[model samples]
Target: MELDGNALGGDLSSVFAADVTGAVFVCAGCQHSGVVASLRVWVPAPGLVGRCPNCTDVVLRLVRTPTRAFLTLTGASRLELPLD
Candidate 1:
């Protein structure tokens, strides 16, 4: 199913040490840039797959295991974290 990126807020914050919903991501595939919150997230997969809103390219994937959470940035070329 399709969900907003905010669905992974707690998981993301724990991994980033800050809220990542406001962070801007530049997709390498189509060069689309937007906040993570605006990305489309697929939750049915084994991991949370976040895609670029404009290009629909997979930008990130977040998988949480019992011991650690693995985050893979697939097509995101640049990430601009918010300045508090």
Candidate 2:
């Protein structure tokens, strides 16, 4: 099943200093640009995986443990976060 990026709010907030749902992401694989909230998300995996809506490429991956949170955006060439 695929959930929208909004599902990542709480998890992402754990790692970022500000809300990132409105952040824009540019896919490295196809150069597709979109807001983070527009990505497709999967939750049943080892961690939360967010994919680009345009190219279906992996855009971001986030994993959280009791003491640590891991976030990777290797699939995204650029990320633009909203400033205040």
Q: Which candidate leads the pack in lDDT?
A: 2
What root-mean-square deviation over C-alphas does model 1 reach?
1.0
The CA root-mean-square deviation of candidate 2, after full C-alpha superposition on the true structure, stands at 0.8
Summed over model 2, clashes come to 0
Clashes of each: 0, 0
TM-score, candidate 2, is: 0.95
Error of model 1, residue 15, in angstroms: 0.4
Inter-residue clash pairs, candidate 2 = none
State which candidate has the highest TM-score. Answer: 2
- Per-residue lDDT of 29-48 in model 2, one digit per residue for the tens? 99999889999997699989
Supply the global lDDT for candidate 2: 0.92
Give the range where candidate 1 is weakest over 10 consecutive residues by summed lDDT: 5-14
